[model samples]
Target: MTTAGLSWFTVDAVGAAAPPDTGPLLLDLGDFGSDRTELVGAKAANLARASYAGLPVLPGFVVTTHAAARVRRGEQLPEQALRTRWKQLSGNGTRALIVRSSSVAEDSATSSMAGRFDSVLDVRGWDGFLDAVRQVVGSADAVGSDAPIAVLVQPMSTAQLGGVLFGLDPLTGDRRRLFASVVAGLPEEIVSGAATGTSVVLSRGLGRALETVGPQVPGLTAGLRYRLAALARRTRSVFGSPQDMEWLVDADGVLRLLQSRPVTAAAVPPRHSRPLGTAPIAETFPDALSTLERDLWQRPLDEGIRAALELSGAASRAVLSRPLVHSFGGRLAVDLAAIGAAPGPRRSWLDLIDPRTGLRKLRAAWRIGRLRTAYPMLVEDLVDQVDEQ
Candidate 1:
């Protein structure tokens, strides 16, 4: 195993060993030389150490930076090639695989660069398995100029429920509070920022559940929290900021850490003092704007408008001040309006001015003006609201 890019070797043998060959040369975490290859990345190295100490971990292997560099140099070894590598690793068997990006720069002792790489799960067979690994490694190469890709190939363990756990709330970064999100099945969609489903927010009662589950496995809960806190502390130490981690629990209920990184650029800055008075109206408006934008992206205008109105607690049957269209620029204008509305309080007027309601208003005003071509008027009104604020 390699730790922090430092390579070490144990046995001098150079050839592949036969089956049931648990040789001394094959580095486990207990072996220092294995650290040279398997533990090159911080996250992988940490897991190796944890697993070596007899922690519950899914059976897996790591493709070290040395191997990755060899592949990058155009080496034709089938075992080293990602697509064919799995066949050699897994033999001829049908099993689920979890391919993750384990880069030196990611989940480092100091920095936690989150969501800067790729991870693919539930892959089956050698060809598709290799493609997923290649995709992850390639993504790192594309976005991470200086970081070398270290691949962690683990058998996909069963998971009845999986999500993320934070020692502190990600939104507020309050150390006094711990937050957890539990969802059924694998949490791929949620982690990818695609699925917005029911997420349970843990606080007092949930926090107790985290603690109660600890004693069943000695040091399990403590270790998890310790690792999480250590990651956060190290991240802040390295980058002068906090971090967000992605972790999951396997079918056996063993917590297997997947990735860690800094929070997104859009997270609110840490607050040091209490507010003196009510927050500005602009602050509440963003929520409304985000709701509208999300629905618009996920559904048609009519449906999106209805969803937004319902979410904003406004009647969807209210009339609009003007007509609207589905033109490219017009749709873009609505998007901009949604974006603007996201950071502030919802407006009853805006919520009520959906497609159906707007159509009614347009028909009522048909004698006064050409209602079919009045989308610009709605945009103008929204812009005016912002200007007035």
Candidate 2:
């Protein structure tokens, strides 16, 4: 085991000498692979696989599903074993620990139950450790499934920066591009929409940045960019699919792999089957235009829409490159789905009702209020354009 300056060891080292009657209650980080996913759950198993593949994963241990079940049933936990493992992880020093949920349903290949479970961070003292573990284990109830739950415990690193990396473009599902959102502290802020971090786009395999949106973030250096790309490539190679991973940079500038799961939602919807609408576009261009007329009018309309999307940061270049409106028998129909898919400020009432959207609802309402204030000016401009035409 590579401790990386922490006192870490494998479960095999201790389990080999123990009596056969004792089942696996806890396993050290990197000790189990995908085979033990049933016992340790997907989240812990994926982290272990990443560590075994030579990723800079933080040293941690998994309290197995069996142990969590015991806790759930109000059984007396093996206090001695828990204390010994905590000692090894803490290195007998005062350091905060993080206890996170690792249920089988939570980081599966098909669904990533992100932000749905509880994670207790910055834990200290023995009582705090027990409480954090209990909290994580209890969070499994929120899944609404009787799936076995495990708990992952790690000594929280004093990280200078943290963020998430998508091996493929999350918004456009472009496999050749990587999307990164990074912040100065814990990435949970970005996840909760408490902080709108810097968004960066890089070439998937090469990590060469194509564009960056938002302000320049501190500590996101050139070397770190390369390392992040390398990690993405390795994760795809190891997992046989692009992954969505959370990462942190410690005070020493070493990047630590925090979590890894398959990028399930990156699959794009089929383009051919998308239903198109003609209401607004037909109103704009009422008659069937000739080829020359279409050529003259389409460019200006496309340019105008693209300019608005760009100015609002609602759509990506990949989306803008594709034509939003198509002509069938010289009658135009707009790709309404494309506009709806864009990350615009306007959100549906469903967004307001979703508990998961958190602070984003407030942000969206604020943006909508500002847009509403400017609506009259926009209408006046449109009226002037119609009159001139």
Candidate 3:
């Protein structure tokens, strides 16, 4: 995510219901990061990183894991600090609060507890905030782990739009593409899949709506889409990997980050076969492309190549152009245009031998190229034997 200008709008919605400040220190959400996982839990820690990075995270206080343990033990509430914070927020016309679970085991490597945890919204006043905290502690066991669970208390946002953003394409596992499941208003229903949300894809830094799954989301300005994609890319960089982020835009058109986690599943191992549009490689048996397919096969270049077909520009129309060769059952099909192109990172020895051709040697070269394309290892063995002779 570039250092693009992403705005933060504080609306007329709810503010946090902080506990009485009379107790020992409770960490500010901005003070924590990924390193403070043991104290603040995963979500808070990530939010801390976002805040530290100058992201417009909503101001909030963490009811730390230790606080949760203390609360669960039935400690007496000082109650004054809560009133003081509420008074200050209410002074700014922010009256509502959002209480969320920040459990140690919730956003872990093994399990994320997606759609399983609870988030209390529109909580108001100190009593409501305390009740919400009690509720988060109450369901500790079902949320998992013996570790004490923390509750993240923040201002409730009334979103004009909201959605879940994936830093990379999910279906194809393409790192070059980012995808979002977005809704016009709040995303709670859409998140649960109770409603069909708009599907958005951000690829090569450009965003487009793939399809409108259901109801009209309405507020999809181009600027908003760009900001969303840029933010997704940036956070993915910060995490040093792909990220799964829950985000929202308020009625004022400002972006708010709710939560983010490393996309553990996104780190898929590279395929044995290479993808088209990229350069070819030497390995053949499992997932390699041959440098000499054109010679042995004698296939029509314009017909067999996908890239060559595109050379004619708008005039290059095709009935049903197919790839010269398939990779990984057609997932990484060869770009036909590039079949006879120059060598790249994974060059073939056939190219070195192709320029100086003789009749007998041509036949031999063709045979070698053909075999190299078909049985690369066998060709290598043959060449080794001839070199020995």
For every candidate in turn, the CA RMSD to the true structure comes to 16.0, 14.9, 15.0
Predictions ranked by TM-score, top down?
2, 3, 1
Backbone clashes, candidate 3: 11
Please, what are the lDDT tens digits per residue for candidate 2 over residues 1-389? Answer: 22212332323344653222134777888664433777788888888888888888888888888778777766545676778888888775388888988888877666897887789888888888998898888877755668888889998887788899988876556667888999998877787789989999988666787889998998888788888999999999999988999998988888888999998752433333444567767777888888988888777877777766655555555667888778877777765655663322234588568664444445556777899999999999999999999
User: What is the Cα root-mean-square deviation between model 1 and the actual structure?
Assistant: 16.0
Q: Give lDDT tens digits, candidate 1, residues 129-207.
A: 7677677767766784566667777777666555565545544445544555545556575577665434332342224
Q: How does each model score on lDDT?
A: 0.50, 0.77, 0.64
| Order of quality (lDDT) | 2, 3, 1
Q: Give a tens-digit lDDT track for model 3, residues 1-389.
A: 11112111222225643333222335667553333777777888888888888777888877677667766666533345444554554444357888888877766645677766667878876777778878877777655658757777778888988888888765545677777888876667576787667887776386655434455567777787788878887887777877888889986889988888876552432432223443453332334335565334324533545443333221123312434554443223444233534211233588456543344345555666775688977778999999999
* Sequence-dependent TM-score of model 1: 0.50
Residue 313 displacement in candidate 1 (angstroms) = 30
Candidate 3: what lDDT? 0.64
Ten contiguous residues with the weakest lDDT in model 3: 1-10
Each prediction's TM-score versus the true structure: 0.50, 0.67, 0.61
